[model samples]
Target chain A: MIVFEDVSHDYGGGPLFRDVSVRLEQGSFHFLTGPSGAGKSTFLKLCYGELLPSSGKVTLLNRDLREMTRDQLAETRERIGVVHQDCQFLDHLTVEQNVGLPLTATDRPLRESDVSDLLGWVGLGARADALPPTLSGGERQRAALARAIIGAPNVLLADEPTGNLDWEMSQRLMMLLIELNRMGTAVLIATHDLNLIRFAKAQVQARVMRISGRKLQLAGAEL
Target chain B: MSARAISSLVVPGRGQSVWLVTLSSAAMAFLAVFALALSVTSARLAATWSDALAQTATVRISAPPEEMDSQTALVLDVLRTTPGIAEARVMVPEEQAALLEAWLGPDLPLDALPLPRLIELTETAEGPDRQGLRLRLAAEAPAAVYDDHTRWRRPLVQAATRLQSFALVSLVLIGAVTAAMIALAASAALSSNGQVIRVLRLVGARDRFIALAFVRRISRRALYGSAAGTAVAMLALLALPQAGSAVPVLAGLGFQGWTWALPLTIPPLTAILAWAASMATAFRVLRGVT
Candidate 1:
């Protein structure tokens, strides 16, 4: 679980967002929607302890982010999965290798069968040995999703997960996220695509929060 | 994949930095071998000179031809009474001629000239007091001079000791340069592979895991490179002309007996240095990231 209490962040010029108080509970599904350059990605970064809030506290998994050591932060990250819009991957690694990285990085035994099944679930079974550079955009995103969930993190934070995908691929990726949420993993996705939000909202009980006027605002039922 | 395999895959394997570390380690290791050889050889030379000259002294009797034999006899008598003098013998004309043969060619005639008589003395472990013996020789044979070879031994030993120290300092400098090169290579590798690091970090990998990815690969390369360099240097040393009394010190620059095993340690030491250098660079670079 991630809780930001009255957090305000700035980058010298002015605050990107102010007084943003929010809590992402277990098994909850949420969408962070705002215009481009509206601090959605910054919110996701703050949730994962990658960036510190200028004012106020951000607690991750019941511990204050400011007090955690580097190793402790890394340990905490093992329980929080993240997917980026660009689908960051070690291009030299094969798809299956990248997917198994979470387990391997943590010194856990990597089950080949589990990795294979996860690849199958993500529709990347045929491309398990294929390198990331050789994969299509949609395949890359799906592989990224597989990698993020391989360790069974408690919360999933995604920044513009479907920003580069086609509508059909976007829906497909959303369905994957929904399926993951149904299995009890909390998911918070940041995006500017309203149709994707409505599509996901109809499928799961997802609340929509927007960043506007340098503050966090909960969008009403009209969203 | 195994943890090691996964770690290796996390970083791109080909880059200028890889070759930089390998080649620098190899070059530095090669120089280190020669430096080690120089150190060992000089140390041996120092000990040999000290031991060989410490227990011997020579008495030279410079007098008119009529009194040369009597003065030499008097010097011998003084040496006989010396407590630590084990053996004292007047050198035969042929032996004296042989000693001077290198400086004065073999064709030179010696019987017509008034050559000084020489008496070589071998001392016991507890040698006689040099000052007391010299005073006795000065009294009994006014033309007799006692020479302990201290003037020659002191300078030769000092030169060898200084050479050994120089070699040791060279080895230390070589190690430092090798470490610096490896660290620079590691920093370049980390900088060039920023994307890989970001991806690894995003996937919940700890700094240790990420650092191991680079450190293992770099250190292994260093080990291989230094091993090759050490092997080549040893082979080159073996191909040198065999050391002998006639050979110059430079020509005889190599290990002796068990000292040959010293250069073998260079490769592993280089690997350890590479590991430490790259690990430090990795952690420092990572600190700037998150």
Candidate 2:
């Protein structure tokens, strides 16, 4: 549902990537890997309309990112879930409140049962009332994931979702992403974890793309 | 979203403590009322000054006491003959003494002092020929000096006008400061709850929706504060000693009749100010977050 046509992004100094074209189709699983300072986060930001392409076009759901109004982008964001690497959460809010924040902000109907059930799914049910700052790194990541998917978005973009977690915690988080992919939510995750990629290769048919020479190059089936 | 959603989102001073909001509002309300009183009082003072001095003209004659009586008689005769001149009366010794007593205190011995005999003049709906009257009095009695009270009256009116202008300026400045303070507080609250805003934005919440959450909170707080302030101010104004019938200046300082309605609007005005300030700050902050 997201297409980047010759999209070149720059942070005012120089191009982050040049004339990179890619299409993320529905119900597909893709993993983007690159070394540190390879602009992985910036690329994901472009997909969500958080950062506009410096040149060319990035379109989401057939609408140009450059042409959509802020309101329209917000609406589009509801259809695309994003789990940030840092797991942004309001420190003052409890885990439940932080997860339910999207519902409150959008004036959506929220039920206590629905919140408990979602927390249960993410294994954060016991920590529902705990404040975000008091939670462990893995718990915080799960909470962020719960918040991202609470709106039932069709597309999920995770930027280093397991960056702060241990191997076991990362496996749990990756399994959740796989489950979402199985449920027909198009998933694109950016990371530098080769072990995680190898782990995913054993579970499903997934494509691997690497950032090389300032362009996205699709790695062969060896990945 | 419906008003119910807005109410839930705002929670009326929940971001801050209820007690703090109440205390701030009460203090602001208290201050606002006094500002309103001062503004209304100054406005009334200006109107009274304008009304008292507007249609009236005075004639003064400076002449020797021996020639004063004859000069007064001649001036009276000329005034009677003059077309626009209504009626002129010579001030009696007691009346002039009482006039001087108002300034010099009641104990002043007017008879011992060589005070000039003053003649009080009145004009009709159509005022008299001020220039012609002065010329006539000068020619008939060279010592006769026509004092039309313009010198003192002009300055008095100007001072009242300046007071009124100053009061209005103060009201505007107070409103601006209040708005700025509320906006700063809102920005801090929003930034502190940055993740909350981001989640809201991610969930399809429009900027206006986000802004309304803060706007409603500030507006309600401001309303409460200004209302309480206005009421206290009104009570303080009532407690103030009325300038007795003898002291018109003091009497002129308090709100009367329809003027009392003016202070009633201060609360709503403050609420509107808070809404505008919060909305602007919220939108600007949201723009940065996105």
Candidate 3:
């Protein structure tokens, strides 16, 4: 689980986001929505220890982000899988290798058969041998999702996981995210797509949190 | 980390700096082997040439052919009475001829030229007092001058000693150059793979884990390069012919049976140098970025 307490971040010019506290509990599905440049990606980065908060505290898996050593941060990352908006990957490697990267980093010896099964579950079994640049946008999103969950992390943070996909492909990716949440993995997805949030809410009992006026606020039922 | 995990960390043979580490390591190894060879040869030459030239004092009695015999006899008599003069005797014509045979032709007649009569003096445990012996010879055989061979031989020994020092310095410089080159290469590789490293860090790869990939990649290539250099150096050393050579410098180029193993240390030493360079560079760069 990850907890944020009055965390504020500034990118030199001024504070892009301010004093906002939130907690992501276990086995919960939440969707983070905000306008462009609303610090949604930055917030996700704070949860994963990629960037330190300007003030206040952020804790991941009970360890304070400000105090965690590099090794401890790495260990926390092993427990938290993240899907970037851009679906970053080592382009030279095959899709299977990219997906297995999480397991490799954690020294978790995953069998090839199990890796194949995971790819199949993500509908990427046939694209295993292809490189990231060669894959379609939808396939890349699925590949990123598969890679994020390969280590079976306790929490998953997805930043615009379906941003580049069509409605059909987005629905397919949402179904995969819903299935992961059902299996007791805490999921928080930050997106600007309102329809995507409504679609996801219908599939799973999901709470929606929106970033407004530089603070996190739970949306009302009317939103 | 498991071998599989470590192997997965690097894209095999994909780094652009691979050639830099390999070539630098090879260059360092080759220089190291030559340095070792030079040091060994210097030690042997210093011991042999220094000791040979140390305990020798020759008294050359130069005069007219008629007076040469009397002066030589008097110089020998004076040297025998002097303390620390172990055994003083007139050098044979053939021995004197042998000394000048290379500069002067072998067939040159010693009697025709007005050459000096040389008295070879071997020293006791405590060598003769030069000033006292010189005074006695001046009174008895004033034409005679004592030559200890120290002027020419001391420089030879000193030169060899200096050469040994130079070789040691060269070996150290080679290690430093290799480290510097590898560090530059490691930094370049890190900068180029910034995205890959970010992905790796996000997926739970520690700095040490990321560093291990670069270290092993650079070091393994260095090991191969150093091995090749050692093989080439061994062949080069063996190619220098030492058969029946009168020149001590040429003869000393090749090492003895067991001493030949000295050059073998270069490859492993270079491997360690590469490991250290890459590891340090990786950690420093990682700290800067992550």
Candidate 4:
């Protein structure tokens, strides 16, 4: 679980949030909605220990994020999966190799069959040997999702996971997220797509929160 | 760290920078192997000079033409009675001329030069008491001077000692230069692989894990380069001209007996040095990042 209490973050321009507080509980699905430059990505970064709150404390895994060392932050991140808008794969490595990188870092043994099954799940089984640069926009997103969940993390945070996808491709990615959520992984998707949020609401019970005037507000039944 | 641990995370596919690192490491290791060989040779030469020349002495008798033969005979008598003198022999004009042939040519000019006669003395393992021998020489053969070879040989010994020191210093400097090159190359490698590092960090790689990926790549390449360099150096050493009895100057220029294995240690040492360089560079780059 990640909790931000009165968190304010300034990126040299000024404070983006005056007093923002949010708590994400276990087994919960959340969609962070806001316009461009609404600090949606920054919120995900805070949850994964990439950024620190400017004035308040952000707690990760029941511990204050500010008190954690860099190494401790890395350890905490092992239990949290993160996906960026651009699938940041090692461009030189193959698809399957990129997916199994986290396991190498954690000293976990990688079984060949397990990796093949995971790639098959993401529909990247045939393209496992293809490099990231060779993949399409939708394929790249799917690969990023596979890499994120390969470590069996407790929480999943995707920042605009379908930002560059089409209607059909975006729906396919959304289905994968929902499936992972069903398997007991907390899911958080930050995006500006109200249609995707609406589709998610139809598929499962989800909490929609939007940033309005540097504050967090829960959305009603209608977007 | 083992090879399987890295699992080719930072393999040669990154860029041409890996090639540059390999070439640079090979070149440095080649130079280092030569420096090590030179250092060992100098130490051996210095030891040979000291041990062989220390127990020998020379006696120069510059007497009047009339007393020359008598003083030579007296010096030999005194040398024979001395407790530590193992053997003493007066050198005939022919033997002395042969010794000086390099400077004075093989022509017939010995009769014209008023050259003093020389007596070569071989001392026992315990060596002669120089002060006691000198006192005996003063009493029996006042015109004969007991030259223990120290006055002339000390300077040569000193030169060899200085040469050994210089070679050792050269080896250290070469090592430092090698380390600097590897460190710079490592920094470049890290810069080229920045995206890989970022992705690894995003997936929760500790700094050590991220660094190990690069370290293993760089160190493996270094080992390859060093092994090649050492093999070439060993072949070169073995192919060197052997020193026969006619060429005493070349006698101590190379490794003798078990010392031949000393230069073989260079490749492994170079590998260790390269590992150190990579570790240093990896830590520096890791520190600069998140």
Candidate 5:
């Protein structure tokens, strides 16, 4: 679980967000909706310990963000899966190798069958040997998801996971995320699409938070 | 897994190309062996040449031609009785002519030339005191002047000393150059694989683990390269045609006895150099990353 208690972040000389706080517990689904440049990606980066908060407490598990050593932060990242908007993949690697990257990075043992199983689960089995440069947008998203979940992490963070997907493909991805939430993983999806959030609300008990004027607030009952 | 075994897994092509390490190792080994040979030869030459030159004295009796033989006899008698004067053999005309022929070539007629009657006085250690003998000879034979070979001995000893120092300096420069080249190569390889590093770090890999891969590869390559160079160098030195009995200088230029063991140290030295350079670059790059 990730907890942000009065956490503040900034860039250069000015503050991006101040005294912002929220707790993400297990088995919960939350959507972070913000206008352009509202620090949604920065917040996701904070969740993964990639960026440090300028002031106040941002705790992932039991460790404070500012105090964790580089090694310790890397260990923390293993338990928290992050999906970038661009889904950064080593273009030289095949889709299967890209999906199994988490295991390789951790020096974990993997059977040949585990790769095929993971690829099939993400619906990328047939494209396993294909390179990342050859994959379509939705396929790349799912590949990124498989890589994130390969370590069986406790928390999942996606920054615009469906940004480039069509409505049907985005819906399919949302269903997959809902299934993961049902399996007890905390999921936080950051996006700008209010319509997507409204649509997701019909199928699950999800809360929507909007960032405006550099403040985070739960959307009104209508949202 | 042990670092060595793990490292062997990553070298692009190892063991298959015998000449890969061979060329560098042979060149380094050859240079190292020559360095050792030069040092030893110059050292021994200085000691032996100085000892021989230091022991003898030459008396130039500049008396009239009528008094030259008497003065020479008087100087010889004085030397015989002096302490530390083992023996003083006056050079015969033929012997003096042979010595002069070395410089003037055989064409100079030594008998026709009024070369002063040179009396070579060979001294012994404990035979005669050099200073006391010189004073006594001057009194007994006023025109007899003693030259104890010190004029030539000092310069010869100094020249040998300089040669030895030059050999040692060359060895040091070679080692320093080798170390610097290896460091640059390691840095280039580190930069080339920078993306691989970022990927590994993102996946939770420690810096030490990542550095081990590079350190192991480079050190092993250096060791192998140095070994081949050393072998070829040794073989080349052995294959050189032996100089015939005439020139003792060439005889003094080779390694002898246990001195051959010196070149064997070069490969390990190269390995240590590569190891230090690779580790330093790895740490610097890792610091930049985190």
Candidate 6:
């Protein structure tokens, strides 16, 4: 679970957002939407302790983000999966190796069968031996998702995960996230795609929050 | 995959830094072997000089030809009664001529020259009291001067000792330079692989895991490079001219007996140094990230 109370953030040019408060409870699904450069990515970063709130406290998994040591932050991150917009990967590594990193990086036992199964589920089973440079954008996003959830994290935070995908590919990726959410993994996704939000709303009980006028507010019932 | 396998995969190994660390370690290790050889050789030389001169003395009698025989007899009598003197004898004219042959040439007419009478003395382990013997010789025959070889031994030993110190200081400087080069290479490698580090961190990889990746690669390269360097240096040393060479120091420049094993330690020591330098740099650079 992640909680932000009376949080305000600034980048040395006035506040981007002020007096914002929100709590993500256990096994809940949520969507964050805003226009370009409206602090959607920054909001996701704050959720994962990548940045500290400028004016208020940010708590991750019941521990104060500011109080965690570098080591402790790493340990906390092991339980939280994060998918980025760029779908970062060690380009030299094979897709299977990249996907298995979450387990291997933490020194956890990795069963090859599990990795293969995850790859199959992400539609990348045939591309497992291919390097990142050879993969298409949709394949890269799927590989990133596979990597994020391979650790069986308790919470998943994704920033514009489907930004580079086509409509069909985006739907497929969103369905994978919905399946993960159904299995009791808290999911918070930040995006500007209203169509994706509407599509996700039909399948799960997802609360939608919008960032506007430098504040976070629940979307109207019309959404 | 094992942890080690994972670590290797996380960091890309292709870069100029790799070759940089390997070549620098090899070059430094080559120098280290020579420095080690010099240190061990000088120490042995110092000991040899000290021991060879320690238990001996010479008595030189310079007097008018008429009194030379009588004064030599008096000096011999004094030496015979000395408690710690094991043996003493007057040098035969032929022996005196042989000693001067190096400087005076082989065909010099020794019989026509006015040469001093020399007596060589060998002492027991607990040698004679030098001061007491000098006073006795001065009293019995003022022209007979007792030389304990201390003047010759002291300066030779001091020079060898200083040579050994210089060699040791050279070894220290080599290690320092090796560490510095490895650190610079590690920093460059880390900076070049910044995106790799970011990806690893995002997946919950700890700094220790990331550091181990670079440390293991760099240290292994150092080990391999230094091993090759040591092998080449050892072969080079074995090819050097041995005893009876024109240069006295060169005669004993290489290792002797059990000391042949000393140069073998250089490669491992360099690897450890590389491990420490790269590990420190990895952690410092990682701290700058999230």
Best by DockQ: 6
In candidate 6, residue B129 scores what lDDT? 92
- The candidate, 3 or 4, that scores higher on DockQ is 4
Q: How well is each residue in B1-290 modelled by candidate 1, as lDDT tens digits? A: 78777887788889999999889988998999999999998999899999999999999899998988788778878888889999998889999899889899998888877888888999999999999998998889999999999999999999999999999999999999999999999999999999988887877788999999999999999999999889989998888776774666567789989999999999999999999999999999999877
Tell me what fraction of the real C-alpha contacts between chains A and B each candidate also makes: 0.71, 0.38, 0.59, 0.50, 0.25, 0.74
Quick one: ranking by TM-score, best first? 6, 1, 4, 3, 2, 5
Q: Is candidate 2 or candidate 5 better by DockQ?
A: 2
Docking class of 2: acceptable
Q: What is the lDDT of residue A192 in candidate 5?
A: 84
Per-residue lDDT of model 6, residues B61-137, tens digit only: 99999999999989989999999999998999989999999898999999999899999999999999999999998
Question: What does the TM-score come to for chain B in model 4?
Answer: 0.91
Superposed on the true interface residues, model 3 gives a C-alpha RMSD in angstroms of 2.5
The TM-score of predicted model 1 comes to 0.96
| TM-score of each predicted structure versus truth | 0.96, 0.77, 0.88, 0.94, 0.73, 0.96
lDDT for residue A151 in candidate 6, whole number 0-100: 88
lDDT of 3 by residue, A87-177 (tens): 9998887899888888876688877787799889778899999989999887898899889988888999999888888898788778887
Better of 2 and 4 by lDDT: 4
Task: Considering the true interface contacts (CA pairs under 8 Å between chains A and B), give the fraction that model 5 also has.
Answer: 0.25
User: Which model scores highest in TM-score?
Assistant: 6
**Which regions of candidate 3 fall more than 4 Å away from where they truly are?**
A165-175, B1-9, B55-57, B62-89, B104-109, B121-147, B241-254
Off by over 4 Å in 2: A8-19, A54-56, A108-112, A162-179, A191-205, A212-215, B1-36, B50-92, B103-152, B177-204, B217-241, B245-254
Model 1 superposed RMSD (Cα): 1.8
Q: What fraction of the reference structure's interface contacts does model 4 contain? A: 0.50
Per-candidate clash tally: 0, 10, 0, 0, 13, 0
User: Global lDDT of each model?
Assistant: 0.90, 0.77, 0.85, 0.81, 0.76, 0.91
